[model samples]
Target: MKLHPTSDFRGLPPAEDALVRYLCAHAEALLNAAALLGDRPAVRRTARLFEELAETRQPLTRRQHAGIRDLHRLLSLEGVDDPDSLEAACFAEIDPASPVVEEICLLTDGLASRLAALRQAEGQPFGMDLSAAA
Candidate 1:
């Protein structure tokens, strides 16, 4: 079911909610990049997913989140390993007159880093802290 956009942020504390919105903005940035360079079928498909999510105001399911991660991985595989290569690779075949490619690459890399940190932070197994027991 689709969630209200506000509902998506409802239970989160202010900081966490802001993080969610920040991440959503990053996803939108990725979507913009996908639109600009989505000549490939896979990239086009991923863009469609991002579009749908944006329109529906839905929280990502595990599968959808995985798809975002996969898209980021694919972009990295496209030789975006560093700033110089990212500029060169992401701007391939584009007019040098347009200046957004570098920004897109920076956004992509930033999103990937944030996503990685979120994943790592969430990866810890759940358990009670019993160290205070006496």
Candidate 2:
């Protein structure tokens, strides 16, 4: 499937809006893997994302579930018939970047950086081109 169909979310500022979109992408991907391959590994990853979202204590709705299903259907076209092999290959592809724990650290870093920027913007004076920096 198309990993990112468009960067439309760029119109949003980098904070809660942007970070939530990015995390949703990650969560959707994991759920997609589970739907396509019946992969428990993907389910676990998706559950982690769910937990993170839950930390905010926001209520989940039907749309999110639909999003996961749609992504799974689209990505499953290649016929990832064997989940074990799929997970193994996925891990192998990322192994060179570091172990699993460090990989998660990097992902969390991206989310935190975007979220922090948004929070900073909230405290900044509004309606100005403060994004200008040297």
Candidate 3:
């Protein structure tokens, strides 16, 4: 017997929810990066789990490709662990984005503060898709 999608998926404040929250919290900045690079008008909703395909655990999606690139650029400019190397690496565009998120997080509280400010200035609200449909 298959469970209802929502029933199968756990709500927020759980283990999976932790990761979801982490992504959601940062998504405001990440969304700007995505909107700038991707050619689509991003709606306030459906930014994270925009599609069922994203529910799968893959390295990164094609849509997310530009976002990851732009984020690395932004994070680097923000001096995310020495912007020079980050910039040089981004021009190459060969590295994956999953690893970069934590690196940016570790840069400093200042980077986090700046990211929050940028997101606020850009007027990005809370992330829409906080969790997948189980």
Candidate 4:
């Protein structure tokens, strides 16, 4: 998929705008790395999902979040030894000092936290049962 410049997100609520921007940046970084790594097909799938969510201003479902997490895990586990070196090679096309990888990690963590908060706000207890305390 061709990388398109993301539209301005300032119109969204602050939190939503931040989340969308992060996701869009994360997707672009992934696309860049995927192109260099020749893993475009798999990464493109996950990246597109993120892009779509960002564009729609919709919160991710737990399943969708899990899917992205799983894809990330798989990517990370592709080679056991010297993962950083492998990643550096994959991202060689982009400047090594570029903050894409760091930003991607931060965004992923933030997205997970945001998703959990949303779930809690929706009254969905992830692993705790409040019924027993009642």
Residue-pair clashes per prediction, in order, are: 0, 1, 0, 0
Measured against the true structure, the TM-scores of the candidates, in listed sequence, are 0.52, 0.33, 0.27, 0.43
Each model's lDDT: 0.51, 0.45, 0.38, 0.51
**Model 2 Cα shift for residue 21 (angstroms):** 6.2
Model 4 clash pairs are none
lDDT of 3 by residue, 1-134 (tens): 11112232343224333333344455545555434323243323226343322353433333443443234445445333454543334434434566655544453243344434433443544332212212
- Which residue ranges in model 1 land beyond 4 Å of their true spot? 1-7, 11-20, 26-28, 40-44, 51-60, 77-91, 95-98, 124-134
Colliding pairs, model 1: none
Writing each residue's lDDT as its tens digit, candidate 2 over 16-116 gives: 44555665567564454453333565566456545544343232233433333333332332233455566444544444455543535555456445435
- lDDT for residue 84 in candidate 1, whole number 0-100: 66
- The true-versus-predicted C-alpha distance at residue 115 of model 3, in Å, is 21
State the local distance difference test value for candidate 2.
Answer: 0.45
Instruction: Indicate which candidate wins on TM-score.
Output: 1
By lDDT, highest first, what's the ranking? 1, 4, 2, 3
Clashing pairs in 2: 15-118
For model 3 the TM-score comes to 0.27
